[model samples]
Target: MKNYQLKRLSDQPILQTSDVKPSIDGFDVLGAFNPGACIVNNEVILLLRVAEAPGARPGFVKVPLLEEQNGVPTLIIKEFPEPEEDFDPRVVTIEGKAYLTSLSHLRLARSKDGIHFTVDEKPFLFPARMDESYGIEDARITFLDGKYWITYTAVSEHGPGVGLAVTTDFLDVERIGMILPPPNKDVALFPEKINGKYVLFHRPMVSDIGRPSIWLAESIDGEHWGNNRYLFGGRGANNPRFAWEGGKIGGGPEPMLTDEGWLLCYHGADETHAYSLALALLDKTDPTSILDRSDLPLLSPELPWEREGFFPNVVFSNGWVRWPEGSDKAGQIWVYYGAADDGVGLAELVQS
Candidate 1:
């Protein structure tokens, strides 16, 4: 029952809301976090989930969304009267409809050392389709089939679902539409085909009978996914030893193949909604079989920045990349994570 430890690369968050500029005129960048990291042509590229919203007015709650008018996509702000019901600062409920205080879109941030990044002024991928009317978020990048396959969450009136996009070069992208439907998110593809099929890990949210947990799915074309199998963290299927994730758990970064097995980094939340990172190892031949997992969290909200922000006591990640060949830290894994939902931080995964 050994614990996995991680080394914090820096004392402070690498990127914050203030470092990003808003895509829309009236909106301001609220947060920049949960970026998908990969190396393209020797540079570390991060597809950042940039959350933005309009400033609050006197008596109205503001919600920002992407709307279509005359076949053109437009960013619009919707206002609702303050409600009597209990509401979260990030989400407001008005007459049975839920609206987000801010909308999220993916933007590009490039880095030479994988620490300091220069963010693009404009959004690299935004809500253009009907399913993404709310916005896109938490992109997970996997380079497979000679292209970068981005699996992300698309939010709309329907709820959060998994969407796919492909790119050979970061400058251009092609949307493959929504693959997994509503109540599902935290999707990440395995870097290579397994058992002659594309394998992926996703979290299908549960409300009534079960808990939100990780699931495995298979695909032939990488666009259509099926053969769902429950992996961990649901009711009755007890994983009590991993009680830190007693509330819910989900897949994080793309799994990296190792000599022992496939190394997985996932996030979990407890009853208090405190988020932390954990590790697991799955059989290389049959990923459905879990070999070993972290009994305790690998990384948690320890620093002030990680303990406070838009969402407090949260340290979530969807991205990690091995320090490239020839670099001083070549063998170590660099994890890019969202700190308290407001800023980006870096950590080195030390498997002891």
Candidate 2:
């Protein structure tokens, strides 16, 4: 558990400074949300999840900011005068009343140094009619063959699913539609095509067959995916109290392929929903085969900002960047994650 170390790069409130604010007519100018980062055109570009309030009752409909009216952003909030009798906590409900929450949309920001960022005036990607009725969340970007393939979470009343989008110039994005169906999320596509096919890691939730665990899938084309197989399962330590991760583990940023294997950074959560980061090595040829894995966490909730917020004790990542080799401080991966479902956080991972 102590072998791995997680250095804080950018802690909570990564976008909370006075300079950063939700667009006047945007959805999530104030709320802290998740983000995806990539090195593009010598600058770090971030696609952030913008969550906003719907002005409805606390338990009622949640809205998404897609358009502006009179220079003010508008939210499409669902109005439910009457709710159902039985409701599920995880699905979306506070009390007897049933209402929707604001869906996730994409906002654009750029940085020269990967630390300081300036947000774009207008949203880069808005919710489209295809499969994003509930909005998008946690985009994982992979640059391959001159195209940027983005895998993100598409949420709706049915369930949280995975969707695909592509961009060539970062400004124009073409929606590829939903690749993974409902009850699935936390998907990351490999940087390159594996055996002439695209490989991706995903998690499919099954309350009956097995616990929510990581799964692997491959596709000839990046859009259509198949050959789903179980990648990893939950691990319970003998001493329950000492186990930081027990419930589930999911693939985080794009896996870094090395001569030894594919270095994977993933997130694990305990029963209490406390999340931490872990590292694993998979066979370069067959990513489904595990080579090695860290028994302990590489990063965990330690700081006050990380330990407290909307959903406390969580550090979840969607993207990372590795420093180039041949330098004094090479072989380092910068992980950009969401903190407590509020703001974004960063961690530095040096080769061990």
Model 1 scores a TM of 0.96
Candidate 2 clashes between residue pairs 3 or more apart in a chain or in different chains: 22-29, 25-73, 32-342, 62-100, 62-101
Candidate 1 weakest lDDT stretch, 10 residues: 234-243
Over the stretch 1-352, how does candidate 2's per-residue lDDT look in tens digits? Answer: 2344678865445664233455534344434456777777667788887655445455454444334456554545545533456543223554533234555577787887677888875667766643566667888888887988888888765767998889988888998888899889988888888888988999997876667788889988777889999888667545565367677778888788877888878888987889988888899888888988877788888888788876789888888877666534356667888787777777787654
* Each model's backbone clash number: 0, 5
Candidate 2 whole-model C-alpha lDDT, 0 to 1: 0.73
Cα-based lDDT at residue 304, candidate 1 = 98
Clashing pairs in 1: none
The C-alpha stretches of model 2 lying farther than 4 A from their native spots are 1-4, 10-12, 17-20, 23-30, 56-75, 80-99, 237-242, 325-330
| Tens digit of per-residue lDDT, candidate 1, span 1-352 | 1545778999999999899998888888889999999999878999999998898898789998878889877778889988766779898878888888899999999998888899999999988888898889999999999999999999998899999999999999999999999989999999999989999999998888878889999999998999999887722236666566877789999999988899989998887888989888999999999998877888899999999999999999999999777977788789999999899999998757
